[model samples]
Structure formats: C-alpha cells, structure tokens
Target: MTRVPAYFDAFLTAVAGGAEIDHVHLGHWDAPGAIGPARARAGFAQAQDRLSAALIAWLDLARGHLVLDVGCGFGGSLRTIRTCHPGVEVIGLNLDPRQLAVGFRRDRRRRNATWIAADACRLPFAGGMFDRLLCVEAAFHFASRRDFFAEAHRVLARDGVLVLSDIVLTRPPLPEEEVALLADGLEAAFGPWPDKWASLDAIGRDAEAAGFTLLVTDATANTEPSFHTIAPGRSDRPTSGDVLRELHRLGCLHYLYLRLDKR
Candidate 1:
C-alpha cells in the first residue's frame, strides 16, 4: 500500500469532524436546507441545485456505464449519481481511510455503489478498467499532476472520459509576500497545494502531455451562488468570522471543470 501523505490524513480527520476541507468553505456549506444559522432555506436549495447543475455539466453521465468517482467525499456524490442515473455503476475512491469509513458507514446498504480506499497517483485497478472517471475538489492534493494524469489515463478505457473539478490559481502571485500568504493558507486548510499548479493554459498543455484530448473547461464562480445561503455568517472577505473569505484569500479556490478523452 502506498503510504498516505500526512497532510491528507489530517485533512480527512478534520473533515470527518465537520470541518470543511477548504478553510474558506463553511462547515455547514454541505448542509441540506440552510447555511449556518441562516433562516433562509432558499440559499441551501439553490446551492444544491447549482451543485447538481455543475456535476451534470461536468459528468455527462450515462446509464449502464461504469464510472469512478475519484476523491469522493462521504459518498454523497456517489449516492447522488446512483440516484440520478439508476442504471449506472458508480464506485467511489478516496485516499483517506477516515473519509472512506464515513462513506461506507453511510452507504453500506447501497448496492449500486462501492467504496475503495486508494491513492490517486497509483490506482490499484488493471489498465482500461473504467469507462468514465470523475473527480471533484481533490486533484490539488496530487504531488505530481503528470503522474496523476498518467495513472488516470492508464486505467481508463480507450475513448473514456475524465471529468475533474478543482481549484486553480488564475495568475501566479506577483510578490513573494503574496506567494507565502497563499502557501500558509493552504497549509492551514489541508496541507500543501501541489507545487506545480498550471495556469488555465497550462492545464490544457499538461493534459495534452499526458495523452488526453481536452474537451471542455469551465468556471463555477458564475454558476455557484453566494456563500451567504450555505454559510450564512460567512463574509466575502477574509476575517475571523468568515471561513469562506479565508478560503478565497488563501488562493484555495477558483473552480476549473475540465473534461478529457483518453487517446
């Protein structure tokens, strides 16, 4: 078994305790009906709707297909996918044992879904094992994007699709102070962001380098509504009271939804 990174283990532990993996997103962001302490349920409803929209936009899921959910947290997305596409076979994979435990505990009776504790960089399946791969909110933990992409490509069947959503730095920080601030924020939230996050252009280049044909890349900023609904007390700016602000300031977020076809 590949040794899990200490930071990732810590992140899983934190999330299991109701802490958001990203420091900026509120603990209650994933709550079903309301953002923290907010009386408005519409925001929560909209948040769920927007997430469903984003997931569908990214996945293009089909029936009777084998789909892998990489970095699936608590199996919520896996359960949702199975519910949405009843004919699809969905498997959730996570490197964090604690997170997987949570998923399994919550979904042990769901026959259409399976949870696997596995490393993204070195998947345990045979080559061409899956028809589609989906990753949300976890690609940044990969130490080597090239290796991660290569592994995904190796396990994917020819012409299989890969859909991923993650945080990307739009512009390189200009000053040393800015860079340090970003690093510190990341460390506080999870551990360390990957050393080589590319610009949007670079993301495409790297996909090509890993032998994938890029199909789509979109942002969630416009699609996702304000955090006010999900995390009522959250501020737009980083302050002690605003978790979302801290996440944004730390450069911990900026959505990138990408689709690629394996060659």
Candidate 2:
C-alpha cells in the first residue's frame, strides 16, 4: 500500500471526531426544494443531502450497478447512494483508516455500502470493474488528478460515467501571493494538496487525454453557504470558505459540477 501523507495524517488528527461533518463539500442550492433564500437558511445536514441528491441524479444508476466513491470522506455520499438505490453496490475509498473505520461503523446496516482505505492515485482494482464513479469535492487533494483520472478510466466499463464536484480554477493564473495564500489557507483548514489548484481547461485536457469525453459542466454560485453553516467551536483554523471566497473574487476559482463518460 502507498503510504499516507503526513499532512493528511495531521488533518485527520485535527478533525478526529466521527461524523463531525455532515458534508465537507459545498452544496448545490439549486437542488429541488433547496433553492433561493430558503436553502441558504437550511442547516448543514439538509444542504449536504441536497448536494448528494443532485450529484447522484447525474449518475443515472441502474439496479446492480457497481459504483465507486473516490475520496469518500466519512462515507456520507456512499450512504446516500446506497439508501437511494438499494440495488446498487457501493464502495467507498478513502486514505484515512479512522474515517474508514468510522464510516463502516455507521454503515453496518447498509449491506450494499462498504469502505476501504486506499490511495486514489493507485486504485487496486481490475480494469473495467466499476460502472460509475463519484468524487465529491475531494479530487483537488489527489496526488495527481491526471493519474486518478487515468486510473478511473482504466477501471470503468465503456459505458461508465464519472461525476465530480470540486473546486477548479476558473480564470487565468493567480497572483503569486494569492496562490500562496490559497495554499497556506487550505493547509491550515483541511490538509495538503499536491497541485493545490488546476485550471478548468487543464482539467478538461487531462480528462480527454485520459480518454474521457466531457459531457456537462455546471458552474455554481452556491459557494458561501458551507462556510456560513459552520457549527459552533468547530475549529480556530482559518476558514476554508474565506479563502475560497477570496479566490472567487479574484476570478481565480470556482466550484464546478463535471460529468464525463468513458470514450
């Protein structure tokens, strides 16, 4: 097994409690019954549910379909998928053993969902093993998104679909200071990232080079709610939302919804 990164170990240590985050990703307020001011006021759990539902809708899952949730933090999306599509088989792959242990404990009742501690860069499965792949707000931390994409393409069947929601660079090169701030801010809040940020065009190129055809892209404005709903006394570290907001103001970043199919 590939060794886990030290900074990531530190991150898990910082947020050691189980189920502390109902959802770590910024949610889709455009989801049904979650739109407008009402969604903005909804609690963290509700917003996360909406976001999971929206991403799941893109998969078009079928009975007996095999799904892989890469970087499946705490298995929230895994549970959502398994509960919604009980006939589907779901696997959650994460680097943190603590997270996998906690997720397995929480998911014991859902026989269709399971968790594993594995690196995304080097998936330990056979080619054409999965029917669908989902990565929620966690691709940015991969050792190499390009490598992960290639692995996903290799492991997915010809008809498989890849759905990912993540923070992507939306504009031109960032100022050096801004880049440093973004990197430092993220390390302070969550953990280390290999490249920190990649441009949308670069990501698309990587996906195409990995043999995928980009099908859909949704750039959303519902970025601020996740920060707004931070529970009381969660952490004293600088808020990731503030850093992301600054990047957004500079036209340097965005949270994007991407759907791609193996070609």
Candidate 3:
C-alpha cells in the first residue's frame, strides 16, 4: 500500500474518524441546537447522508451514465451512487493505494462500482468519457487546481457537469495575520499551512477558462456542528477539526458548493 500523506492521515482521524464518511468537511460552523451527545451524533450522521444525496441530486445522474469520483475516500460516495442510482457506473480514483485498498471492500457484489489508483489532475481515463466528475472537499490537496480543471474539462462528455464542495478564502487575501487558538490538534496535524488556500473567485476563473459554465454556487452555511458533537476533543490542545473550526470562525475559510457544466 502507498504511504498516506501526513495531512490526509491527520484529516482522516480528526475530521472523519477514519470511517466510511462521505466527505470530511473542514468546518462545522453551525450552532449545536441544544441537543445531547447521542442525538448530536445521530444528527450529524443524518446530515452527512443528506449532503451526499444533495450532491448526487446535483449530478442529475441518469441510468447508465458514467460517474468519476476523483479523490474518493473509502468509496463512500461511490457506494452511495451504487445504492441510489442503479445502472450508473461509478469509479473511485485516488492516488493512495492504502485508500483504494480499503475502498475496494466497500464495493462488494456491486458491478457498478470500481476503484482506481491514479492522480486527480492526471486522470487516466479517455477524453469525453464521463457524464459527471465529483470532488468532495478534496480539491485543495491537488498540486495544481488549474491543471485539474483542465483535466476535468477534457474528460467529461459534452455538457457534462462537475460538482464539488471545497473550502475557500472569502476573497483574495489582504495583509494577513496568523493566530493559533490551540497548541496541537488531533493525533498529528498539518504544520503551519503553506499559502495554498484559494478564493472562490479564483476557482471560478479556472473553471471558466476550462470552458465550463457556472450553474450553481452556494456556501454551506448550515454546516452541521460535528466537532463538539461527533468527534472527541481535549482542552489542552485542539483536534484538527478544532483548528479548522477556529479558522472558519475567524473567517479565513468557508465551505462552498459549485456546479459547472462543460461548454
């Protein structure tokens, strides 16, 4: 198995508990609605399923359409497609063999689901083959978002849609300040972030340059309060989830969803 990247490993543990979650949204900015721990867990679980369903709905998938989930984690969303959109073929692509190995077990007895070890920006598929390409809170890690956008445009069939959720700075950065709310987060966490955060405007420009027309864009302001409720924490130091929640609270980043159609 390929070695997992440190930041991704940190993300898996702190954000998704290394489980079969659909997506590890960086921040849960919503207020915990006066609920108990057990109820909170249930609520967050439901919210995850809802988000997955919403993305699928945005895909507007039809039977026999080919779907590619770039950066698929444990194949959760691919399995969701297999269950909900029968006859649609779904492929889960990830660079990490460790992830692909675990994800392989998730697609048992399912002819519609397949997993591949590959790079997101350098997709191995033929041009104009896929009806949909999905990225669930996973694009930031790509080496070059522009390259990925170009590749996405090349691989999608005519009028195919690209639906993705991502974290972005509200706008272009001005003079910046850095502050730490906690000493440490998770078992291990990403070191001081390198200047990789991109604004929504930047991503939109990249998509447009790649011949995509924007169909929908919205911030996930109603993100569930999963940090305090679903994931464990400590007072001495923050979990990786805490670091992200703090960043979101500080307005450094926001979760957003976008749908762009191949033009």
- Best-matching candidate per TM-score: 2
Q: Candidate 2 lDDT, tens digit per residue, 64-95?
A: 99999998877889988888898999999998
lDDT for position 194 in model 2: 60
Worst 10 residues of 2 by lDDT: 226-235
C-alpha lDDT (0 to 100) for residue 156 of candidate 3 = 99
Q: Which candidate's lDDT is highest?
A: 2
- For model 1, how does the per-residue alpha-carbon lDDT over 194-241 read when each residue is reduced to its tens digit? 653466667778789989998755453432334444334533644322
Of the two candidates 2 and 3, the one with more favorable lDDT, higher being better, is: 2
Q: Which residue pairs show collisions in model 2?
A: none
Per-candidate TM equals 0.75, 0.83, 0.81
Candidate 3 ranges with C-alpha deviation above 4 Å = 1-4, 7-39, 170-195, 229-233
Poorest 10 consecutive residues of model 1 by lDDT?
20-29
TM-score of 3: 0.81
How many clashes (backbone atoms < 3 Å, residues ≥3 apart in a chain or on different chains) does model 2 have?
A: 0
Candidate 3 C-alpha lDDT tens digits along 92-112: 998887677667765576587
If both were scored by TM-score, which would come out higher, candidate 1 or candidate 3?
3
| lDDT (Cα atoms) of all candidates against the true structure | 0.65, 0.75, 0.70
